[model samples]
Target: MCVMSRRGRFQRGEGRHLCNLSGPPSGGSASPGSFLPLRGIDLKKGGRVKKPGRKALVSKDPYLRLLVKTYKTLARRTSSAFNRTVLKRLLMPRRFKAPISLSKLIKHMKGRENTTAVVVGTVTGTLLYRDMMMYVSTESRRSSDSAGEDDLRVNEVPKLSVCALRITRTAQARLLKAGGEVLTFDELVARSPTGSKCTLLRGATKAREAEKHFGKAPGTPGSSTKPYVRSKGRKFEKARGRRKSCGFKV
Candidate 1:
């Protein structure tokens, strides 16, 4: 027969065996029909299933795996937060390792001169100023060229000592031409075991093309999110609630 306890728990007593419908009662005998005991759950351990994090490197690259191993050892040995952070970043996936350009790196390194700049991703050769000028118009480029010698300095890549996982050939050439040094992770560790006088930098996370289509639904009022339209032609998504003549716009 089932009996409700003072605590409002259902307790079924069948002969000498007791079954707890909720869980084992405190200081009470073990219930034969308790699911918690069968599932091997300990109430003392906060019984919620824990979500796991990456325990090992997912990359097939032997060098990257070795790097992770080395950092793991470093993190275990050193008390520096820098070593721990580098180890965590090194274990991240490729998409999280966003590439940083020389122009942006130069801008970030300003006022923090002579410090080793570390990036856990690729160092690209794309010039931000030149790209912006080109995107503006051909006339703007001509005007920029005719501006002055001072204006030309914006295009000049500066000499920088950078430590990164990978560096493009174009970027490497530019750095070398400007008397810069590109050091590997091992070299960086050898120089500063505790990561002293080092500047950590990361690429723009929201700069990806896919990020533009992520927020609020398209066509909603005040929504700026891009729609997953097949084409950009006029016959596409431009009708019904999109125009004043189309049965009143949304």
Candidate 2:
């Protein structure tokens, strides 16, 4: 029977054998140096081997699965890097396919006119309410009521063509109002198989709230990482390393 040595190397009964919980094989005793190989692993290699890239989609959504299937075919048939990238992104989980706002998309597409903007994720409509209010207040302060209204109209979204996995209702309404075109992956494939004149965009991956506490520990000198705390009040995570009065501050 095979055994493991102190250093974790497999041995031919040189070390303590595994308990004979089920006794030997039904036919006869196991050979002295024999070892059962693990499925999908090579004992000679000492570890499991796997192919790179996702083998299959993990999501059960029918629409998402269909999109992946289409992209997979495109990636295999076409030599376009865009198709390959889209296929890879399609296979990713929801978190990695971050949601982007329309404002950010307009900003990125500023100088690239008459090209399709492609995103392998959802497109959100507007900024948060607080930000929207702030924007309106600032615009109102800049000019008279009539002039401000005209300025707002002039700053309208340009005619654009966008393709994404999903789009929020407000975003779609805004796009349609501006005479822009919203497209799906299949439609985009039919239009431009090689992805010519298409610009790829993605949301900020580190913009998630959970990412705020991922860097250096909170209270560490020169570290801006946020601490996971229940509250910001005086009683919660505000003493010791957080304040100079309670022991030395970091």
Candidate 3:
């Protein structure tokens, strides 16, 4: 029931016209009255498809660049042995506390810088310590007793702990004031060689608390510095007096 005529074509007593949605198709339909889909949608694919290109990383972000710079600076200034021994210990599982207080850890580490204090020390050859809570532990003093007499030897453990650092509002302003930006959690955590987002963040919090007179509030969701946010029942808030703000150096 279809054929071309003076007024386009007729199909089932309905007048329909041919159309080209794209410029690619070659053959023309016989009826010219196919009306269901309006035609020509498939014709534009080849020519209109976008060519792939290289994706630019977010390295351009000032905060990201600063994170990288800070990492290099600290790594260069700090000892590999110290960083490796202390940072790795802190990063260990079940060794750190969540929502950790920064100022306290820094003060404690600096205060006990000379002593082999284990913020993350354990009796099982692991370390665990919390400055804010005045907590410290280490491999239980290795003790040896000579059966021959009342002679005893005490093996003192090495004070192999990180020196905590604290960054106050003035410090933050100074860092950011000079065209710098605060690090979001991810970036700060990334500073660690392990790429552990959480451990490094907690370590940073502990480190920053080392400085004297250092003070700032915690972080909240929607904060510019709040880096990690998972959708589907998880979201990070960026607000004042929140942990994410002051703990980790961004």
Best by lDDT: 1
Model 2: CA > 4 A from native: 1-53, 127-154
RMSD of 2: 7.0
Residue-wise lDDT of candidate 3 within 1-250, one digit each (tens)?
Answer: 2334456653332234434333433686544344433422233436566655322223355653453455454556766454444434333343242233333333444544433222332112112243323432322222223233211221222232221223345333332433433343333334444333222224333432233223442243334332334542423443334444645432
Q: Give the TM-score of candidate 1.
A: 0.72
In order of appearance, the predictions have TM-scores of 0.72, 0.72, 0.18
Q: Cα deviation of 150 in candidate 2 (Å)? A: 9.3
Encode model 1's per-residue lDDT on 176-204: one tens digit a residue. Answer: 88898999999998999889999999898
Q: What are the lDDT scores of the predictions, listed in order?
A: 0.81, 0.79, 0.36
Count of backbone collisions within predicted model 2:
0
Report the alpha-carbon TM-score of model 2 versus the true structure.
0.72
Residue-level lDDT tens digits of model 2 in 96-190: 89989988898899988699999999999874243344345565546756553433422467778999989999889878888999999889989
Q: Looking at model 2, which ten-residue stretch has the lowest summed lDDT? A: 13-22
Off by over 4 Å in 3: 1-24, 30-102, 106-192, 195-198, 202-250
RMSD of each: 7.6, 7.0, 20.0
